[model samples]
Target chain A: MSTFSKTRPPLLETTRPTADQTVLRVTDLTTGFRRGATTTEVVRGVSFDLRAGRTLVLLGESGCGKSVTARSLMRLTPERAVIGGSVQLGDEELLTLPLADVVRRRGKRIALVPQDPAGALSPLRKIGSQVSEVLRVHGIVGTRQERTGRTLELLDRVGIPDPQRVAGSYAHELSGGMRQRVAIAIAVACDPEVLIADEPTTALDVTVQAQILELFQDLQARLGMATLLVTHDVGVAERMADEIAVMYAGRIVESGLAETVLSAPRHPYTAALLRALPVPGVRRGELQPIPGQPSAPSERPAGCPFRTRCDFQHDACSEYEPPLFVTDVATHAACDLMRPSQQAVG
Target chain B: MAAPEFLLEGRGLTVTYGNGVRAVSDVDLTVRHGEIVGLVGESGCGKSSLANTVLRMVKPQSGTLSFNGKDLLAMHGDELKAVRRSLQVVPQDPSTSLNPRLTIAQSVEFNLKVHGWGRRERRARVMEMLDRVGIPASYSTRYPHQLSGGQLQRVAIARALVTDPSLVVCDEAVSALDKSVQAQILNLLAQLQRDLDVAFLFVSHDLTVVEHVSDRVLVMYLGRIVEEGPATEILTAPRHPYTQALLASIPTRGQQRAAIHGEPPSPVNPPSGCGFRTRCPYAVDACAGYDNTPHAVGPDHAARCVRLDDLALTAPQAWRNS
Candidate 1:
């Protein structure tokens, strides 16, 4: 009855090279912007991998460069910005690829679902035309009839109640949650090997946020696309991430399996952040706020960026930048206290 | 009559906007001295309208409002101005609330100046309040753009409290800041509330934040209070199905996956009886034209439901752990 029921199943064979494998590998990724005379490094020396059907969330607060890092991975940074890193997608390196090649791969190989769907969507165009445009540009489905049918099917798959009506409606005619659903439908139209969702539900309502997250999980399982989610909400990260990489002032302070790092984080920043978050049972006025503001990218201190605010700071924290130390539990933390030579951070 | 126990009280307040939208419909609200009452709901739930009513910003079409044990709606001219000084509000966005041209000290001092404080006294008070909010004396001269979101928020709070208001209404004051920064602002607000003995009408869409800061919680759905009670009681053992659904929708708290679906009914033309009946999971035919009246479930705890007795046997707890 559906457009894809007979010919295709999520375009799986076209995108997936090998099922359930590491499709994208990134290392030492750095992004910097030149303002006036100085170059401020926003994302410095970050490394991680994205596997098929797994989500690796780059979790951090606003100025921590999580968004800039996501932009760097997608090669969506401005022309003035400086980007450096090894980004491996199968046999090719994404960063070193030609401009045309990267453009070709953007929607077909690695698609991006931006934060504000209202802003991301074309206000002038109808919802169906936009999705069909992506399909037409990629040359995936031929003919006007097939494209129209496929757009409706995609919208339906994203959980829009009345796909037929929604296809004819403009972006403004839909709600925040519906606009996001349409954005997802467009992103997954070509069945990219990697999908980068940057704050997909941040602008939406809390209830709507939960529904969108469930859709992301559902689509990932069905399509088996490697997902890289960027969010500041710890709860969203906990809900979606299989592996979590906590970023701080341009660098990843912690990385590991979500279950291990979230439960018992080795980094002081991560521990303080978790405690500071307002969970359900934390009684009134019990939040332990980390003192002082996070350092800007340009104004990072001599050694550790978080030393000025960290409660467990010692002599080593100011003298030498701590490397990511893998604990016995396999969780990695970039802290002097996590070093074998140092005692545990109290 | 005995002296009113509550500092601010509104009886049967109904606020209807010009666009034929009834924002606040027959809402009875109250806040005690030094107590934090959280007004929570999604967009268009009229939580802001209730706060505006308390601030006397919008005149209710039909309601008797009292503040500081005096009639607020009846007061006019200078008397209203003098009384309304004590009803200060911290706006949602700190960046816009503050003047870009003005320095941090100038911004906080501007409020004191309006209340007709002397120049020397205003300068002294601004420094003291800035210190209390964790903004250094040196950074006080910096412009709004020079300060971070958290610092700007502290400046905003200092500005709001500079007049020494009795009831400071924080309208999503921390919603703009990052999580860590939000924590800092929340802690500062709570500490200041106790130190100054000022009641707060904390308004937010975030249930976690509302539960964290509020002593009592008011759940608004389509311009009506669906549930109201002590924070722990309302969030942990919510009697209203709407409150339970909100609790269950929080990913960190209930179900490990959010289940609540569908958009809220339009405020202009809400569902006949229960506004929440459209999205409520346990909605029934009896819910139509059900009056949506409040029934007291405990001390200061009430819920609007026709089947409270039926739900008492089945859904008693908030199901946060579930």
Candidate 2:
């Protein structure tokens, strides 16, 4: 009965986007980086779609290619990164866009609210000035005074107390929760169609974490923007996501409605994730952890990425990669055990 | 009933830095022999500061600390050294606390050697402690960097326990490990407490891990304990507004979500009356004028809110749902 694990509802309901609207469409996405003489394929054959106003969570452990997938979508891929994929933001082919165009697209078409807010916000600059700088870079506001006024408004919108005073305070002056609020305000300043939050509240305390998650839920409704929340915490995924895509290595092991996936997960990895939740009332030390560490990009196994750790893995699972199979129109799982005929697809 | 045999006690302890930065207020805590007391709070809640104070790394500005009837604050010279040898710490970050150059066994045995134990005795004790922490003794010759986060933490605990310290302070100890690893370490700590009768000062922001291990919980804010009680009672029916908000904010399995708005107030220039009143939803004008002093609200339950009249001491709706 620790005070830290109590659950709270998402502050709002999911926005009902028109059924035909697809905010993001990613297909056959592959990315790799060179280490000395060898090129390591970090993310291989990744594909998923995010709908307007819906939360599509990329769930996985550290280095499971979750962050790489989100980064590729924004074309924020590093110079060391070599990417091949089809990433379409609405009608625009994001992967094929020019470098200059991609720069323009950042914070305008799509924005990222990074993992560690304390690190993401510049330590040297005042929070308000840092937010205004985003507006200035995007050329959204013409004058400095206008941008300052807008920054104060943004601070107020994010629930910062004494907006004027906070505007003049440096990042060090704010707490972790306040810094996260500043980061959120910056991400939404351009009114982007998509907001990608990478472990936004992982480092925060429970109460502070709840407040930040509520902020995202509130913004998603008011702005009608598609949100991609990336986290490893299943409890967080349950409270925040409209749709969940459980990632393993570099592939989506399971993708389905949040309720369906959480309540009755099909993929082994998804099931393990749900079972691993340290639910109170369940005897302690009974948490069934997903067995092994995620595979390294250079050390990609021959067949199904999860076979080494999967309890139900069979001989065939080590010979060929399992294809993502549709269980329903809206639910898909890439697992040999979940869908035995998965190999027959494509 | 006889009072529980306490291994360590901090009575009216206070630690203050220059510029009037009071890190630990008049705090009282007891770690019963063979029991774990969870000092749970967010960053800057003085959990670390209090731990350092107990270790005598940072001298307290006021109050007394004792271990097994020995006055920790008054002990000096060789007496202090003996006290230090008996009360050890398993710090949160293994990467920083451990020496890279020394092998795990050497690191552990160094403590024994400092206490003037013979080389053979050191080796035997090192192996025994390693086995106790669930680390294979064969891996002892490997350097600290060769170990995983979980393994390194075990080594850290083994090193602390080698000298047979009665009280061990774990500052955010298991927070660095992965979820499964956290469970294993917590289980290991609990098992060690049961078998060895070691008292633990468990400091962490992770409530799940804390509840799983701690017998009693202390909720700290701005260097003061807002509430202290049995884990189940505090978790189920938190009487303080700050405690309620903290409980409501976490996303636990089976619990309903109660989203708190805004972040906690700045500790440096904390608000008048209750430090939590600025963001508290139930705050009235009376709360604005309330003194920043602790008041008893229930048996073993205390809060610093001025709105006890208007304060709806209700169980967090989130927990009820769970």
Candidate 3:
């Protein structure tokens, strides 16, 4: 644990934004889809703030609404889907904006680096043309020559060697890591104020994934853009996040500084997730799996959604929905274990 | 030293696709009884090709494969079928691997019926196997779609192990699972190994998972085994440059990650001399002309690197310290 601190001193000390400097502030954001007569809520009031030059990672398991939450910010949910709550980029209200305005804002002010780079990119187009499309649509550059030059520059910035050859290659011709680098190059073409990456490296191999993550850090440092990284890997979250938000069945279960939250998680679900990882130094067979599967939104239990799998559940855990209880100055957790009355039992 | 008993052995295995791409080349592997040998590499590094060739699912161009003291490459017809009962496989995706039209009970029993088990014995054996994998008997009648990914994977394991196989080839068995479910499956595999004494050829890209379950580990690069040794020694003190880079790339909970440069070279026409020389940080001019062969690093550990003699290698953390 100390090794992490030794290698990279807290960049937040110099890059942390002061008060009232939040780049993207999401409040009580909820999204739902209606199929026939049934309406199911996929994202249930997930809220977090992304400050300039800082990363706030939404960490959770599959079907935990982390992806949906990222999608909700960009209004990328399916057609006819019901969306609620406020998504404010600075003074602009993104949720209530007109479709035309939202379309204009996308890829210019709020860009997205989606998961599955192979699927995110068009196989028919060359990597150069695809990246130049963002610049053309956003009007970031003046002429076609400028577009090509900027596209090559962005590719090189993302750590792709021999940018000219890569720019001429199609998506299928490039390797997985090269494709992902092209995706990031497009996302940062216009230098968006906020970059929402949804499991950007999930499909890559470990070594390639490490390279991509380091590229993200480098881009963030140079461009000073607020990054909202969505991933199901706790190890990734620990390495990349300045602030951490643990999401469960659509709702954030805990939020705090990465060091505080990862070192001593207040929520039981977060603790269980950290425990589930097969850490390098730990002996085999010592891993404790969280019992029961994560329930879908349609099958969410009453009160606390995690009570069904929680080992520390009591009568109060299922009796009432627990709110985020402040455990420290900057740490808050949505678990009954933090309640004064239930504290004794825990 | 006494000769060790090998449940499965491959000598100079080579596989080439129809497109003239050599997927696996000149590789030797052995899994002793009651041992778990993990095969790890990046995607498209011939891990799956090698595992499938051993399972007889894919034909090798040049190799001698033997299982349970029988020459697998020479077996024909009934002999091959008889040996297949002792060699089972659990594939990566449980959803696509299982028959969707069949119920869980029917799926598990299908294997036994193919092996010529009677009706009454097959039903009892299916029930017992399902229970052992932690799936309840009541859900045996449900379809594959009705079960979660974890439960479906358990059913897959139950089907593979119902015959009491002497060796099982788990190809990315837990890679698609969630972290918690992955832990449960790994623990279950370990428990089954202890009880059944079945040797497993575990293929995965996850080093952490491989280090946790494997007694010995083999690191692959560009369709070649770059390092082979005991899991503890290989992970803690790797001798090959590629193995060191692979270990350093793993994102531990609170450790700083080290990035390896560039993508792997194309297997169709890999770089001459060392396959990893193009991406190797310590490559020298001589590396381009040196022969790749096993260099002993320990009593039971060996690496295929020409620089093992003159160059000193250290773990990723050591670089960080210096």
lDDT of 2 by residue, A1-346 (tens): 1223223212223333453368888898998887778778878889878887788888887777889889988878788888897988878898888978877988976999998888888888888889998877877666777779888988888878788998999988788888888999899887777889988888887887887787787787777788899998876887888888888888888888887877777787777766655554344555666654556676668889888878878988888887877764347888775564543462
For candidate 3, the per-residue lDDT at A14 reads 38
Off by over 4 Å in 2: A1-20, A281-283, A290-292, A298-302, A327-330, A341-346, B1-4, B252-259, B284-322
Arrange candidates, best DockQ first. 1, 3, 2
lDDT of 3 by residue, A134-251 (tens): 8777666667776788888889888898899999999999889889999999998877888999999899998899889988988888778899999988778878998999999889
| i-RMS of candidate 3 | 4.3
The list of candidate 1 runs beyond 4 A from truth reads A1-15, A343-346, B253-257, B312-322
- Residue-wise C-alpha lDDT for candidate 1, range B71-124, written one tens digit per residue: 999999899888767989999998899999999999999888888899999899
Separate DockQ for every predicted complex: 0.55, 0.30, 0.47
In terms of DockQ, which candidate is strongest? 1
lDDT of 1 by residue, A211-253 (tens): 8998998898888899999999888887788899999989999
**Predicted complex 1: DockQ:** 0.55
Misplaced by over 4 Å in model 3 are: A1-20, A340-346, B1-4, B253-257, B316-322
Clash counts for the predictions, in order: 0, 6, 0
* Pairs in steric clash, model 3: none
Tens-digit lDDT string for candidate 3 (B151-242)? 99999999999988988999999999999889889888988898888889999999889988889999999888999999888877889999
